[model samples]
Target chain A: MQTYSLKCYKCNVTQNDNSISRIFCEKGCNELLICEDISPMKQDPLQSMRDDEESFSLGEGSTPLIPLNKIGKRLGLEKLFAKLEFMSPTGSFKDRGSSLVINIARKERVAEFVEDSSGNAGASLSAYAGATDIKAHIFVPDSAGKGKLDQISIFGAKLHKIEGPRENSTIAAKDFSKKNNIPYLSHNLSPYFSEGMKSFAYEIYSEFGEVDHIIFPTGNGSLLLGTWRGFIDISENSNLSLPKLHAAQSSIIEPIVAEFSQKKWNFDPSSKTIASGISVSNPPRLIEIVDAIKNSNGSATSSSDNEALIWHEILAKEEGIYSEKTCAFSFATLEKLVKSGIIKKNEKIIIPITGSGLKETT
Target chain B: MQTYSLKCYKCNVTQNDNSISRIFCEKGCNELLICEDISPMKQDPLQSMRDDEESFSLGEGSTPLIPLNKIGKRLGLEKLFAKLEFMSPTGSFKDRGSSLVINIARKERVAEFVEDSSGNAGASLSAYAGATDIKAHIFVPDSAGKGKLDQISIFGAKLHKIEGPRENSTIAAKDFSKKNNIPYLSHNLSPYFSEGMKSFAYEIYSEFGEVDHIIFPTGNGSLLLGTWRGFIDISENSNLSLPKLHAAQSSIIEPIVAEFSQKKWNFDPSSKTIASGISVSNPPRLIEIVDAIKNSNGSATSSSDNEALIWHEILAKEEGIYSEKTCAFSFATLEKLVKSGIIKKNEKIIIPITGSGLKETT
Candidate 1:
């Protein structure tokens, strides 16, 4: 097994110890700890290995990359592909992260954990915990959609609905973990969890080769950061062109967008957005997410609930992709990027439809 | 393009005339028409062709075959696999058939169509119709799940909810088609739709090779007959042991099961079961389904509502597969088949979890 180290993305401070029980920089820099594989490799370790490996899978990964012809034609683009991440076992891309995080949890023999999510991540953790026989207590905002909550409980997890804002749920979950002396496997802050998302980049590279652009729905920037690292790993051994990564978020609560776009923005916690998955106003890894976009020469854009809902309808009516409103941000922002001539008409672009409409509330 | 013919499954009667505009035989035989490709192919045309074959796809096919380890161990089985069919676009296995049927529809230039479904097939057809220029009028049972109905309408299909019994929807759909002089693309009776499912067998052969057994939740028997025919086609040119194909249905109304078990049974429309997808008392292809089962030396079994719900919970809790209760019938009956020594303890088995639980009623 190759040794892994945690490095602060902002300060470039590296910790040689692999087993540091640290969420970020030890100096309290409030930065994201990026997991870096110490050893260099030419290919993805997960792809070459057989299924008989100790890694657990709830049928996650290898989601479809389909061309959005009808919508693409309307946008005056030749190639627009959607990676249907919603088809994951838990009906969201969080399954990719949860699969790896829970595998490590199982290896460590952590019997109980507490975590908070808007909805998808909670459901994802509940599923992996149920499959691995780990007791989990998930905290979600009381306003979270019923489908995601029902999904969490269906997998035998204890669901705690916090009545206040989404941040309150996080605080409650962290307090519970601290009081109970159990691990808090926060999908947002867990370095191990984001490592699982690197598979997305590897799959995109292997299947579609080097696409010109990739857009992602950014929340805590799990998918965004993991994908960047994945491409960086691949570039270490191969002469591959890394696609320019972009982030799309709900206009109402656009922390990452505000940071990268250098716009004066104030986040309103009371305000609500239909794309609850990306409704994170004060993302923990805000700096790291902005840094990832800056490093990749990517742009951050935001869309309104109405625009997203309209695009959501377009995707269903035109492309037959029944995805959550959160995913519509990619398409709506794609239009903006195309209009500004930031993305050319003929470039092959890929977007991750991070969640399914089956769990969406009208 | 190879010519295709529809032949009666009962009498082995071949018809060279391709366009009789008939769902079944014109002889009033109450039998399903089997699609036979005339250009004698050694392999599936779908397997050998490239993507630009004019066939429409919503990322259907190639569902994961995950091992149900925890449940398998408890059941004293070594190899227990589940084909997660619910992950298909529109959240059901119907997408497979809809892909091919609508491809043929586009080629046929039939603009307007009427179809009846419990839920999954209607949503699938509606999605395909929305993708193309075809106008789809979907007639569904009023008692159908809300998620499926919403899904149909989301794709811009006209939805007609019929009251009183599942048969009323079919009647209404057929009547509308006749009155409007538009084609009726009945997924339950469409021969082309089942041809789409042939890819399932091809995928199984290519991925896992020849397994000992494959089980399906039987309603109109589209999947079962298509799989059997696909294996038959493959067996003609290749040396492979055909898996024993099994059928499962709700205990309340199981025409195929009764026919195979040699038991006289009556179906009550009012008797409710959670497996609404398979609540068909009078499947149009009853004889064909039974014939497929018997020819493969397979048996049929039925499970009570309580048993099915119990197994459904077990699959969700143990295997991390959140599928509809309709799929639970297969697992419930599998235990009985194993106990009866029909299915051995150590044989490799695959069951198609036919629908996602996201559409299940609260």
Candidate 2:
């Protein structure tokens, strides 16, 4: 068994036990739990998070990393690639996190759980929960996409659609979890969930040997932080330097970008963007996300709804990549990076196509 | 550089050249063409169909082959596997075929082409055609799902909504192609499209060492026929034997099943099923499909729409696999096979989840 501990990044307090209830720090720091100090373990990276028998999957990882030939030429980059993360079983990258989170839940003998999401994570969690015969109560904003809502319900998860903003759904979910005594298995805060995303970084390393940069479609920053941790894990005894992990968010909700760039930005309730996946007013993992960006010497940028939609269409019509609208944030960011001479034309860059276009209604 | 010839199954007529126009045998054998005399090629299997430079991919192959433990237990089978073929670039197994068809079209310097599909193939071909910058006129039935139609147009394909039965779309597409001087790249009839599906079988062999049986959700039998050919390719000069390739279809449209069982059955225009992907009344490759099943010592069976939906739900709620309703046909067929003692509980079986449930509207 791989030995690891859940340590609070803020308080630096470590807990060796694997429990779903240990979400935040016991020091009242309210920071998310993270796997900090770990013994150099087996070659199997999945063992870094969950046990062998506890390893559950819906064929989540090993997504395709294809060269974006047409999109690259248009963006003035000679080597731009897209990791088709949306080609997952549930048609999103959340499957990776869900696999780990639900696996841990199963290992801990948890019977039920509650999770909140705009859409992707809820559907993903519901799917995994169904596989394990664990009842799931997914709370989503009433405004979540019809496709995602349908997907959530299809997996036999009890749907709890809350009114108003995405935060309302989260609040309602937490209340339900506390009231019903169900474990709140939030993908954002769960260390195992983020730990599952480490597979993405490892896959990129294996496929490309070395990547110059990776611009993610950021929301709560689970993927970003996990990828950073993943790169760190791989770079333990090697001369390999971590890739510059860039963050691309919607201008409407650019908490990570604002913090990284030291710009004054606030939540605007009225603001809406086509990139609904990253429409987060407040991300709980803001500190870790910002730290990763700063530590990797990566930049954070935001794009408007119009710019995002334009890139989304270009990905479909030009490159035949029918990714979710949120994916365009990375392309919009890439264009700016190219024009500003931050990312050179010859350097290899990767963008994760986070979700499928099929998940988004036209 | 991989030498091959398009040989008519019935007439013994062979064409050495690769041309999109030569779909049928010139000697009035209305039979579909197949790659017959393929020379022993290099190490790469992709080169068997298309040249290295002409190869196009949206990362279509290498789908997850996961063991269906829960569903297998329910079906009294100890070893049942599901090849999540729906985890393709276009959310369907058709992408494998589409990759080759479009690649061949691009190599032939075809600027424009017309194709007809129920939904999956059109969306798949549209995406590939978009990637290659080829103008595609996709004729789909007006009754096709809204999700599929949206997907077709999203890739910038000219969507021709044909009225009446699915046959109407094929007739309209062919007529349009003839009038516009564009090659009709029909996914059903194109040898290149079916040739591309050979990869599916090769992948299964690589993953499982050897599969005892494979149940395909049959439409035009592209996947089924190609998989058989793939096994034949690998079994050449070896002790390896081809797996029993079974065909599963909707009872509403059971042409192959009726013919295989020597039952008197005919197509009914009013017949409808939720499994829209396999609602082919008249499969042009019927003869070849029957031949493959018989030669491989496989059976052709079908299930009712009610049964299909039940299996579809069982897969989602029980197995946590949210696949299209068409995939249920395989499960329904499997149940029948198990009950009839044709498929022993101990033998390994594989079913391809051909498309994503996200593509289906609730």
- Which model scores highest in DockQ? 2
User: TM-scores of the models, in the given order?
Assistant: 0.96, 0.97
- Second chain of candidate 2: TM-score? 0.96
Residue B356 C-alpha lDDT in model 2: 91
> Measured against the native two-chain assembly using Cα atoms, what DockQ does each of the candidate structures obtain, in the order listed?
0.66, 0.78
Across residues B224-284, which tens digit of lDDT does each residue of candidate 2 receive? 9989988888787557867999999998899999989999898888877887888888889
Docking class of 1: medium
**Interface RMSD computed for candidate 2 is what?**
1.1
TM-score of 1: 0.96
Q: Interface RMSD (C-alpha) of each candidate?
A: 1.5, 1.1
lDDT digits (tens) for residues B156-259 of candidate 1:
99999999888899899889999999888798888888887887888888888888888898998899988988888878878989889999988888888889
* Candidate 1 clash pair list: none
Residue range with the least summed lDDT across 10 consecutive positions in model 1 chain B: B42-51
Q: In angstroms, how far off is B271's CA in candidate 2? A: 1.9
